[model samples]
Target chain A: MEKVMAFTGDEIAAEAMRQINPDVLAAYPITPQTETVQKFSEFVAEGRVSTDMIRVESEHSAMSACVGAAAAGARAMTATSANGLALMWEIIYIAASYRLPIVMPVVNRALSGPINIHCDHSDSMGARDSGWIQLYSENCQEVYDNLIQALPIGEDRNVLLPVMVCFDGFIISHGTEGVAVLEDKVARNFIGEFKNIHSLLDIDNPVTYGPLDLFDYYFEHKRQQVEAMEKAPEVVKKVGKQFGELTGRFYGLLEDYHLQDADLVVIAAGSTAGTVKATVDELREEGVRAGLLKIRTFRPFPQKEIIQKLSKAKAVAVMDRSASFGAIGGPIFLEVRSALFEEQKKPLVISYIYGLGGRDTGINQIKQVYHDLAKAAQSGKVSQLVNYLGVRE
Target chain B: MKLKGWKDIPWGGLILEAGNAQKYETGGWRTFRPIWHEDKCKQCLFCWIYCPDGSVIVEDKKVKGFYYEHCKGCGICAQECPFEAITMEEESKFRKDQGGRP
Candidate 1:
């Protein structure tokens, strides 16, 4: 009952845009993300999808245009990469504070200093606490599938925050993989139509969109934001269930591969998670009780689920493609530690920074992480809380 | 314990009647003013460099003056002075000629 086609992840994203058929498409061109906008531009050229693609000057304007469009009661989609995301950071917070359900596909890449155009999670990591729901994709399939899932999760009545789908740049964005795209009618029916509960463009009912709140009411508004975020897990679970029913593919806040009855576990996110799973499979063949915990949603962090999963393991290795300088560990590591703090028996969690600056992290390094985790579990003490897995110097 | 007359209320015990008024004071506030000690001032221009609102003025390797009208009282110039020359003080006592509203 589904239409299947052999498509790459980028093509899948482009076709997903066609299927979703947003009213406004605003994004700037950046590496590893250029293909998506190109394909979308072609879609606009061919008259297949009727939407207004605004070519903005900068990523800030791209997000500003998206805020305007979303406030105008339109379903909008945008694509960006590392530096572009950094430029749009201010407006990204504004979008979330305004509670606009704008969906953005972030081609995850390393933030620049020396300059690298490779896959990493640093871009999304820097924007972690910006009040948007972040969803990480492990493969080309999830990249396509999660984009479809993000709409329902974000547009739910209770949780009306923006959603960002992050896929590893060049790895999943550029790498070719087989993907199945459902028909436009099917996706449209699945995601339904955009109903604006509060729109800025409605002249019949006069209302204010975003007004400055004084000190007396500021805390209550922020508390309301937290309340909306706390309510997102229910929407995420419901949308995951509906997407599974429709697409026959299941998604969770955290997807486990052989995590049950495992002595050691390696937690990862983004495309590198696939490598971790592959290495886990090989280690299992050799009688190593190693498992993989692929994190899907990072924000509105599934803290309860993570605490339950990792509390039972002997040792856990958290692999982050980003760094939090001067902290005890990375951002994900900090959250995981806090989540497991209330539990009686907490696993020895060590944060490992890898795949930074676009360096490819193969299965060998993942095996090394597992080996180090096993050693630490055996000794019952962490030699290093944060380990740089493979670095030139 | 059960008296229910209007004069028995707590607020009704006051000596003044309801429409009676008393004089009010409106001179409790004052704006900040920056003063530079000429003896300790070396004219290093650090105050000019550090002022957030560009309220300080330095000319010809000497302290010329500063504009206190638009100063936000952020204390950046006073904190950043190398010689601790700038000190903040209340502008002056309120007077009718000094534009007191009341």
Candidate 2:
């Protein structure tokens, strides 16, 4: 029987991992992400799940172990946040290169300097092009749903790639919300059995993995990875449909909210989308035409769908919690602008960088954005292409 | 074997054919080639024991000519031959088929 439980994003992620019962889980703990692996470890100790829990020394070793286990034909998984994700950067690429379907839950946190352990997009955005499917969650429920769906999306024959499920640190990761938890049997049946390809442990037909490709074949292999990423969206769609059939919650590359007919639109991902959604409703009730495009899948970045969604709007605002430094706006903003470049008539798009290092982004700020949009819509121009939110000027 | 294109090659650069690395003639890297003298004294089999790459051909408890295909010309066998039965010769001296010196 399906039941609703009040769970923090971290706790829900642990619950989902427990349901999947990955053959091996190799992880190093970091804050926000720590409670997840900690709770899963308790499950391991209690004999609730039969997963081989590898307590790796660091995030690098954690990913390395997951890569090894996955290559050896075990269903492998890991969870990390912030500096831990940064440390695993190198092997994260290797795991994708090897076409290993390891699903990792990354509790989004700021990259360090004047160190702060708070929520931001910098960590995952830094790894946007590392050849893994990235899923962004707006709430604890999406966090659970995304994690449950990751295995099938990645293990598809045409899309043998790793996946990273990202949610805001402290915001979603620490905050508790009501999530409808699927029964263990239903969850198991949804994922089905694991079928690996060209595993290292297939002793009958010996194979060599991670071979020295050199100039002769390295480019060709990279092309193969590109093809895999190209094939991922359709597979993600199919899996999402199947998951929705089992449960009642459907998923897609991006969540369309009040976007059908609107002059002003806001494109945002992660927990901030919920804020945008609430603010969009408020604007609509107050007789303002406002809508939101909540990004769910950020990697196989839904370019065509995004263009169709925002093409007719007078103006669009992309909310990025991470700074891009030298680039024009942040990561999502750059992509949205680039996607619009293909349209003959497109929205006047701008960037709003907000919520870095766990800064509070409230309803008033979102409302202020719509007010700015009202002015920009009438004036046919934006004063600034890039604006920082929840920060003093 | 023919070289493969991007689409023709296996995904992830996997080598499905196991132990096929032997086909690549690494002896091409050799600068000095070893000449084994069968007429000279002892067949102590020490060369067979010391040859790196298993290039020393062993038949019925006796040493035969070097395989030459895999020999890296390390001269470890020549150094181990107490009877001075092996000689290291300059590789570029011979033709491609080991005929007369160029």
Candidate 3:
């Protein structure tokens, strides 16, 4: 084990980029996400890594340039947040649909109508259908770790899909936390070199990419993207286990804590999961049967792992940082409901949307959620599909 | 590993159909057909200079036109023509025979 000084979340993410040392790193900065690129630029300027760090005009061109670079068989990376990510929406879909295998870090934030530079899952959740493999981080360590793990999982021979490693904007992205820095040689060996099977601009092969496929072939391409996304969980687990062996930190599809002996559990992803874990500790100290299931990977949804982990719990409180707007409930809760609906004894799953626009989510709100879960278990009924925490009307 | 006749196939294992070269016959449509109104002709070749896709061709003192098989109908020449001598009339009769713009 290598010991280094405690580093901030942004510094750890930058070190991972330094280790990966992608051939192409293109980005236009938005708040919270700017630090990753800044440190990356410093690394490039100092000759620590030989990377083409493109200072693109907008997030659109940043992603567009990355798409071209990846198609040219270069190991590519980029970063953005909130509106920056929203601006890259079109090309993000293009990168995934074409299976370009680019890696991106999204400092997750709320999409603006009122303009917020705060933590939320809105940016990443809005891009769910874009076919990118999405991984959410619960802490600074996970942010550093997920970027290292995302490389091979994304660029796997069978997968060949783009990946987005999301950490909460301002909450995790800007918030400083202690993280153990791994050796460059170790990280490089862990991720290995990128091998592009089908690059667009390979002159020696001279194959045309992103052609007008019309209906006859477009559906098959989309179907293949779906199939590739399905293949990611196994790849993620395989890569995660390999990482654990190398670093002694185990990551899985869904990380369960104190759930084995508890009857009520709270589910959350991103930075808020840390608060939920803290809340679980308090609940257990009070002799309440409460636990937490922190989701690490959102796409490839981790349906089976979620079902198995929550099957024994009497009730579940799903905390979502983003709203699905209509129909059933919160995005995470809707997925959880669908996963549990077919089980013989389904728990009373309730959805709660909290911590929107960087509103500070303390242990009290999490404690309140656990209280609701316990009440639901006692009453044997779910009061509502979705509830907003900390909102006064 | 050297499979004959498969070298030209695109990846995702697409089988290139035969007679793909004839698809290049649309090269005839690359140039624009300028209608010369000998009465309204100021003979300014600004249309030839400003065309980005280079659809116009100027020869000698007289402006001889060609068929715009690949003309995309951008009408840049029509926009740039100083004399209003060039009109972007579609190949109505030929298009009527070939369904639409070939």
Per-residue lDDT of A29 in model 2: 82
> What order do candidates take by DockQ, descending?
2, 3, 1
Task: Give every prediction's interface RMSD.
Answer: 20.4, 0.8, 7.7
Docking class for candidate 3 = incorrect
User: Which window of 10 residues has the lowest lDDT sum in candidate 3 chain A?
Assistant: A199-208
lDDT of 1 by residue, A93-174 (tens): 8888777889999999888877988888889999998989999998788888999989989988788889999998888888
Best by lDDT: 2
CA displacement after TM-score superposition, residue A20 of candidate 2 (Å): 0.6
Candidate 2 local lDDT, A1-393, one digit each (tens): 689999999999999999999999999989879999999999999999999999889999999999999989999999999899999999999999989999999999999977999999999999998999999999999999999999889988899999999999999999999999999998888887877778889999788888777877899899999999889989989999998888878888988889999899999999999999899888889989999999999989999899888867998989999999999998999999998897789888989999999999988999988888888899999988999998997
Q: Model 2, stretches more than 4 Å misplaced?
A: B27-102
Q: What residue pairs are clashing in model 3?
A: B29-B68, B29-B69, B29-B70, B30-B70
- Give the DockQ of candidate 3: 0.08
Candidate 3 Cα misplacement greater than 4 A, ranges: B1-102
Alpha-carbon lDDT of model 3: 0.82
Per-residue lDDT over B72-96 for candidate 3, one digit per residue giving the tens place of the 0 to 100 score: 5556777788778777665565566
Q: How does each model score on TM-score?
A: 0.80, 0.93, 0.83
Residue A187 CA error for candidate 3 (Å)? 0.7
Error of 2 at A109 (Å): 0.7
